[model samples]
Target: MVDESMRAALRALPKAELHLHIEGTLEPELALELAERNGVMLPWTSLDELKRQYAFENLQSFLDLYYQLMAVLKTADDFRDLMLAYLKRAAADGVRHAEIFFDPQVHLGNGLDLDTVMDGLLEGLRLGRERYGIGGGLILCIVRDLPVESARHVLELAAPRAADLIGIGLDSAEVGYPPSLFADVFVRARELGLHCVAPAGEEGPAAYVTEALDLLHAERIDHGVHAADDPAVTRRLAEEHIPLTCCPLSNRRLQVVHDLRDLPLRKLIEAGVTVTVNSDDPAYFGGYIGANYEALAEIGFTYDELKALAADSIRASFLPEADKRALLG
Candidate 1:
């Protein structure tokens, strides 16, 4: 149960979720529902068994199961239900705004078109605004482990609908497909009016963070926990006010860091780098945005620090300036 003191604090605060993956929000119950509706056969018969698989030796292990679950999501309605479920939980956790990521490669591999995925996601987001009053945006991320040509094709598709697609990001594994591999794709994305962001410093080195900024022109860095490795890069990021969307639990779960307290979060903040805590994948990573805050707070961040983190999330988001001000104010 949520503690009374923490519950009050969590409810009253306005939060912006900066690093969630829309597909990663697929809870087991909804997975079953979608599977049944689509007549898809899942390998697991029960939710308990599915939850057990969440334990991971590394990022690759978890990704295998993550991709396996995608088989159940094949239609527009499945995507809508996936997003609507996340929105409901996020609203309950006081998420005022969210910049959600979705991998088009995964959906397209399942024979789903970009329009189908966008239609469902946008429909759910519209319903979220009307019903839950949540402000949110979409970031179509490229699965970097795939061919660069695939990323280019996705970017080409996103260019025409650039208004709906606010940003482009790099997700999937970070070790092999470093930020430099997607240099051309990110350049085109930025030219087409899409903000560029990428996940580095999880399993990758500090060099990847530098490449994300220099080569990919990433506006923000996701999972930048290892920036502390290089004093010069850390100072440069801080000096430029580049925000780092740090996912505390995802770091711990993926073995990016030993523990929450062991994380360089407080250090990153102290170093002048803007840091925002987020639930990278609520269902797969174990909690929602409020749970992420609660986990960090338990490790001893002060109320003012929590507020700063919340504000940083909004500042790093792609929300319209007016909406950003309203959320922060």
Candidate 2:
């Protein structure tokens, strides 16, 4: 069991969230509200019914439900309200800084325009900073399941509002769609001076993580727990101090690990890699970043270990070092 002291320690430390999906923050209650507002009829009529569906057999199982709920997100207010709601929860959980991932390609597939998605999320991020004092930015994702031209089109749209977005990422199904598929996408984003990160080695192989680092030149790896599967890559990640954004709760919900104790935090840490805990999808997988820390504590994480993870979080973030130090203080 996690003691109150361990929980308290985690709550007191301000940390950065580096692996969150903005859409994954959509709670069942908020989903229902948005559905009603947008005049959409959801298959799950009640909140409890939707909650029951949150349990997933695997990553794709969860993605199906996650994308289905997003049908209600038709207006800018829906998106802004969604962001504010998540920022409030994150702030309450002691998130002082965050880099949120958004799937604009998925939104576009839903027949939503680029401006509506970007404008509302940027507005909500602005409000999150003003209202919650939570420093944040957006990283638009390229869905690997889509064609390269679709991603290129999304990038073109991103160019106009490049100032509002800080980075580009590859998300959605990772099995067949390798990081190498988006190599040129990252090259263009890097040329435009946007930070790059990729979700790899979670459901895919550790080699994919190396591909992301070597080919895509991703600054950080999201849900990189499976990188522990490769000794050489793991060692290099340790020696090079590559940050692996680990999401424990999401791993369990997605059946990445059958047991919370088997989450591989210790192995990654022992290998000398800078591992930071985050809530990939709070509402669906259950719990925010604080609860992720508490889960680690329950599995034998000490106060110092928790502190180090918190520190690693800020260091891995896109924030300036001076700002990082201030947040650290």
Candidate 3:
């Protein structure tokens, strides 16, 4: 639906990605390559077959394949290669800053230690900054369906390294697990001065959004697409200026929103809510940050809307005020 000029402009805009899962950037080529190197046998025969398997019935369905893909990523070099590949694509797509999420439970459950994961990823990130000039930050997220004690243990593992890990987040299946379940862990994260965020309304109800802000004290809401269903909740979020990181393509892929028409971005923006577009799981979601913007453009976003969305991303990021202003400028 977007014209050539509009697509060009969207590509040229400098943007920040705030909701990316690093593991989710595992492209088809890299996934298979890693599988070969690590001696892990996958169910699919060819990469095209693997791509076809990305179709999801729901969040849990996607998580099943997502975890299976992790079996190929066993060593430090595999992690480094994964992040490096994403950064290369990000730099080309005009992503100036990226706040990346990593699920430690997935890696640790696969017998990879936090240190190995962090060291490899941080090395790639540092190299990306120097080689590609891409700014980056790390966020450690807990799988919501997992036990509360597991979330706490992950927090403890990350607390001492809070300087390296900038934020704490909750992801995975959001329907059954509510933010209130991790109240103690979120509290501890805040007490330690780490930024907090959670995906509240992807599959969760509007009340779960309220619990995220009130009980978990989350600074931002990720994939809060359903907040539009509640006027009172929508008004509060708009008035308070809490940012919602909305992923259009991801929603379509996960069946959260039936189609691009189901996206509430324009409505959210019109109602004065700060909604920023992101690619939640780029590999699974079928694009990176730029593709998310392009998808919105095809759905009828103007140049100004693109600028506003980019600005929202800046405001939504946990970067220092000066850094944000620099990016905004």
Candidate 4:
């Protein structure tokens, strides 16, 4: 078990959160509050009903509820409130910097314009910096399960707001839709001067990681636990100094592994892979970045090892070198 001293240490350690989904930060209380404020009707009448649904069987099951809860976020204030709340929680968890993901495609499908999402998020980032002294930026994620043309359309829509985004990422269901399918989309995103990252080797095979690196030119791999399944791929990740943002709680909550001990974090770290811990969807997965570090401690990571993971997180983030150096110190 993690002692209070260790928990305090974990909370005090400065770190960067690289694989967070902003929409996934919607807690049940906030969801209900937004729903009622927006006059939107939800299937669950009470918080208990919503909390009970958090027991997900897999990624798809969790995603179904994830998208459903997004119905409450209708206005710019809702989005801004969402960002501020997440930053507040993340700040207390020792997050000095955060590169958060937002699914614009789903919001567009919800009859909202891109400006509502971008403006609100940007404003929230500005306020978060003032209030919590936390630096952050947005990563516009392409929902892979959607049509390829939809992906292309969102990029076109985001072109004007390119300056607001730090990167573009591919997320959503991973099994059937591979990274290769979105090569053109990523190519366009790169042309717009956006860094590329993708969710691979989560519910997909290790080969998807290779495809993401080769075809999509991904700079970072999110939830890349399965890369440990292939020695060659593992070697490539280590040799190239590519980073994997591993989320222990999300993996276990989604049943990617039946237990936290079954995760390949230690194997990847031992293989010289730059492994950094993150909270993928904290509100849904049951923790923030700090909780993830504590879970690693429970699974046998030493204090020095945890500190190394924190350093790796700062290195893997999209922050400027000077800012990273300041945080590292």
How far does residue 87 in candidate 4 sit from its true spot (Å)?
0.4
For each candidate in turn, give its C-alpha RMSD to the true structure in angstroms: 1.5, 1.3, 1.4, 0.9
Q: Provide TM-scores for the models.
A: 0.97, 0.97, 0.96, 0.98
Model 1 lDDT per residue over 1-329, tens place:
44789766965688899899998898888888888898999887887887777765677788988898888988888888888899999998888888999999888888888999998998899999988999788999999889899989987877788889889998887888888888888879888888989988888899889999999888899998889889988998899888999888888787777778889887788999999888998898878888888888888887778987888888888888888898888
What digit string (tens of lDDT, one per residue) describes model 4 on residues 87-118? Answer: 99999989999999999999999999999999
Which scores greater on lDDT, model 2 or model 4?
A: 4
Q: How good is model 2 by TM-score?
A: 0.97
Residue 173 shift from truth in candidate 1, angstroms: 1.0
lDDT tens digits, residue span 22-62, model 2: 99999999999999888999998998898888876677778
What overall lDDT, based on C-alpha atoms, would model 4 receive against the true structure?
A: 0.94
| 1 or 3, greater by lDDT | 3
Q: Give the Cα error of residue 74 in candidate 4, in Å.
A: 0.4
Tens digits of per-residue lDDT, candidate 3, 111-223, equal 98888899888989998998888899898988988888988888888777888988899888887788889999989998878899999988779899999999988888999
Cα lDDT over the full model 2: 0.89
Highest TM-score against the true fold, candidate: 4
Task: Enumerate residue pairs that collide in model 4.
Answer: none
Q: In candidate 3, residue 145 scores what lDDT?
A: 86
Candidate 3 accuracy as TM-score: 0.96
